[model samples]
Target: MSSFFSRLKQGLSRSRDSLAQLVPGGSVDALSEEEWLDIEDGLIMADCGGELSGSLVQQARKRRGSSIEALKTSMLSMIPDAKEINTSENGPFVLLVVGVNGTGKTTTIGKLATMFGQQGKSVLVGAGDTFRAAAVDQLAVWVERAGADMVRQHDGADPASVAFDTVQRGVARNYDVVIVDTAGRVQTDRGLMDELAKVRRVISKAFPGAPHEVWQVVDGGTGQNAVVQVEKFREVAGTTGLIVTKLDGSGKGGIVLQLSHTYGLPIRYVGVGETLEDLMPFNAEAFITSLLPEHAVKS
Candidate 1:
């Protein structure tokens, strides 16, 4: 646990720095109205979003004890949903992942496969980002690292077809889990989103009740724009959860809480670096402590 906490703090150092610029010393005592306003804006800048930031301020104003602790409880209370992967009812639990390029979609999949593989689950990966030959190669590398098999097609092959083939293979082999990766679809474009819809449809056609989870990956560095991306992807893919990446590279890790607070959807995982093990489950306590060290548990 301490090792994970150390990683969490190291991963969130950039965001902590960004937040420190707002509160300076991380103090919450006798703040002037102007200082309070700066704090609120600072949180929004950290990608906490305006609504959640305002709510935090309101709660802090009335707290009888530590303002930072009160803020922690307030944020924790907003996590109304936390999803756990369960494979009891199905032979191969399917996970469909979508995101823009460079959001670390492939890495996220690889990390998940590694984690599941460590649990002794047989995993199969579908390289559905067929437009880019490099995407398949990248996925192939991670698949190898995770000790999982991959189903891939030549570049320019239909992504939906790859999804279908992967599921069929997983079913035949009775694999524990099958994860599919799709091409990066620009959320604002109708045609691109429509293509994603088609991929989802084909997955359903191949196996009903498959693709049990559709997770949208977002680059947390993009801040509030990540929120818009999630909203759009959810509309197209019925995104069941989120995987936020690039936290170590961006000062916007707070977007996790903002998304959880706004959509109440589960944040399944987050990536802090390029390594397969850099991706970790979203621990609410660790996240809050990393961002607001004043609230961290005393040794």
Candidate 2:
């Protein structure tokens, strides 16, 4: 747990700096205008957004015990418990991975492959993003590294076809899980997003309820724009979970707050570093505690 906290703290230095000043050290009898303004500014600077930061500050002002612990509790309240990621007894759990290109979607899939493979689950990967030859090749490399079997086709093949084939293969081979990778289409591209819908429908052609989870991989560095991405994808692809990547490279970790506040989706995992091991399961409490100052941890 200490090692996890250390890595989380290191990855979220930016948010920690802002949050360290956000919470008052001890209980306060009354809220000063300057203090309230400073608290709001710190949360906003951390990228938690104006609405959440303001409401959180307002909550603090209303509480007699607005101590650092109180603030930590308030901050952690925004994130809910994530649903368990596992193979259902009925069939293999299928995860459909979607996002714009460069959001680390494929890398996340690879990490997931490794994570599941290490759990001793036989994993199968479907390279459904056939629009880009590079995309298929990159996913192939990752699946290989994860020691998972891959089902892909030549560049420009119908992505829906690949999804069907992968799910079929997983069932036939009795694999524990199947991860299908989709093209990195901009959310506004109706044609591409609609194509994703087709992939989902076609996936059912193999087996109903096969793609049990739809996960969107968002770039944590994208900040507020990530909200827009989630909104659009949720409407189009019916996103069930999120994998936020590149937190180690960006200070805007507060986007997690906004994401949970608005969408209420389970954040399955987060990528803090480039290695496969760097991708860790999302734990909301640990994340909030990690973003607090060292003094707060000791307390």
Candidate 3:
């Protein structure tokens, strides 16, 4: 397997280890109803969310028979599969990446650009976060690292105009992908959200049915608040997908389940570490299995 998958698997293993501590296995047959409630509490503490965890426990109780192994096997099947990207055709697959400030939105874009470029696709980045001079400079560093072209204007330029120019350039050059990096503002801010909508409209006008994907980047460390963030972004930007970052740092990674269940947005990718390759496509089974204790895996 690739190093990215290996790290993903490893990171998941840590999460599983944490989860195992919450759900101790005694023979379920020997446990009281109170014991089962304890197990459910563990799941909730893992950030699995009450609805999903409760549903899972109820299902497990109904189907209980022999080994904890069998129970875990069934439970693993409950998590949804990761979202897959269709990179089949060429000619400008545009991704509009957004997130709140300090959510590592620009860094995620840089990594994504590198990944696409490494796959032999031509990429053009749009510096659409015109409010911050640093945003443009940071993305420029990514452009250089990824060896992809960028569309940028001076600081304080209209972000929608930047997006317009970026899409125009993409169509003219027949670029394989155009990743637009937008400013990460609070989704509740009506003015900023309206501006984002304007950017989308500009892109659509330039290339109808374009802005092929609107991806929201959420910090995994933010816990349940990330869910609120996703909901707000979806309301404003009509997000089609999610990218959860900082999974390697905290035990709150269980928020992935909450995101999948609440938003029904497929997790396209996860940020595990700081390196470019740290980002990996989400794998639900591997992820859930990784959350199990080493002893559970062996048992």
The worst-scoring run of ten residues by lDDT in candidate 1 lies at 290-299
- Candidate 1 regions with alpha-carbon error over 4 angstroms: 24-29, 86-88, 295-299
> In candidate 3, what are the lDDT values of residues 176-280, reduced to their tens digit?
999988887787789998999999999989887778889999998888889889988898788988998888887766788778877777888888888887888
Candidates in order have lDDT scores of 0.83, 0.82, 0.79
Better of 1 and 3 by TM-score: 1
- In candidate 3, stretches whose alpha carbon ends up further than 4 angstroms from where it belongs are 26-30, 64-90, 296-299
Model 1 residue 266 CA deviation (Å) reads 0.8
Residue 175, candidate 2: alpha-carbon lDDT: 88
Give per-residue CA lDDT, model 1, range 172-243, as digits (tens).
Answer: 899999999999888898988998998899888777887799988999888878889988888889998888
Instruction: Give the alpha carbon lDDT tens digit for every residue of 1-299 in model 2.
Output: 78776787788887777666655455645556776677778778777899998877776666666445566677777777786765568678888899999999988898899889999989999999898888788878988888899999988999999999999998888889999999997998899989999999888789787578899999998988899999999997889999989988877888887788778998888878898867888888888777666542211
Model 3: how far residue 103 lies from native, Å: 1.3
Instruction: Kindly provide the TM-score of model 1 when superposed on the true structure, using C-alpha atoms.
Output: 0.93
What's the TM for model 2?
A: 0.93
**What TM-score, over all chains together, does every model reach?**
0.93, 0.93, 0.90
Question: Global CA lDDT of candidate 3, please?
Answer: 0.79
What's the CA error at residue 112 for candidate 2, in Å? 0.3
Per-residue error (Å), model 1, residue 296: 12
On TM-score, the stronger of 2 and 3 is 2
